[model samples]
Target: MYRFSYSEILEDAPQLARERERMAFDRALHLLRTVEARGERGAERTAAIAFVQDLWNVLLSDLLDPENALPEALRSDLVSIGAWTMGEVGEALRAPERSLAALIEVNTSIRDGLQ
Candidate 1:
């Protein structure tokens, strides 16, 4: 018979939580970029806008909430980057090439700002 150690399970919780948050953030970012690249307009645009708005709302709230388990610096960075990415996604949906170029520029600026 195989035995499961409770200590090992407890030790893995924090790392697992971190990984889960990271994955969620990444998925949200990917969806934003996909919506931008799709050049969605009309109802699609509305849906995409709503999606990003919801994502940012949740992310910012989580970052600011005292009960959140993430590190403060990481929380702040995630909020900042999520906001910047949302803007870029909006621009891309509106203006494609120009927006894509602007996204690159904005991403670079944000990275520099974080430093």
Candidate 2:
């Protein structure tokens, strides 16, 4: 077995974390598009809403934590973006002929940026 250096360990953890985050966004994006195509009355809508809500909830909690490594300004901006995203989720449910374009767009942007 090979031993890992401390710097490698640190670098590896964040890279892994970013990949996980990217995958989570990927899942959410897929669900959102499925919901769009299938209509909001189906199981797909239920799943998409649940996944997006849960994903953002976890991210917001992390960003709000005082010990979070992200800079304060960046964290604050993300929190604001999350708030908007959550509002869109609510609207997507409550409005007739609701379009998930905003949700899809924002999540796609963030997912692409995770690289």
Candidate 3:
């Protein structure tokens, strides 16, 4: 078995955290775009709704978990994004064309805020 150095882990932590956040954001954006393209009036739309809901649930849980190792500010930001994403997802489920723009706007706003 290979031994991992403490210094290596510490050095990689920020990059790892950034990558995880990027992956989550990308996944959410992909799901949103898929739903938008499919329209919001059938089984596909419902599935997309479920997908976004599930993703946000996982993000929120991670942020709120006591054992989560993220900094407090980062955790708070994740929780905020999860809440905003859930709202956008709900709007998209209700009205795809109208809500898609709003969802995209919210996503962009959140990304800007993160930066």
Winning model by lDDT: 2
Which runs in model 1 stand beyond 4 Å of their true positions? 1-38, 86-115
The best-first sequence of candidates by TM-score reads 2, 3, 1
Can you tell me which runs of candidate 3 are displaced by over 4 Å? 1-27, 104-115
Of 1 and 2, which scores higher on TM-score?
2
Give the per-residue lDDT digits (tens) of candidate 1, residues 1-115: 9853333432568566445445544554455456567855456555645655665665576567676665888888777877777776666556534434444444435334433
Question: lDDT per residue, candidate 2, 4-78, as tens digits?
Answer: 533344356988778888999999999988878777676668678879999998888777866676778888989
The model with the greater lDDT, 1 or 2, is 2
Instruction: Return the TM-score for candidate 1, rounded to 2 decimals.
Output: 0.47
Estimate TM-scores for all models.
0.47, 0.84, 0.60
* TM-score of decoy 2: 0.84
Query: lDDT of candidate 3 vs native?
Result: 0.66
Give the Å shift of residue 102 in candidate 1. Answer: 7.8
The candidate that achieves the highest TM-score relative to the unseen native structure? 2
Model 2: lDDT of residue 33: 88
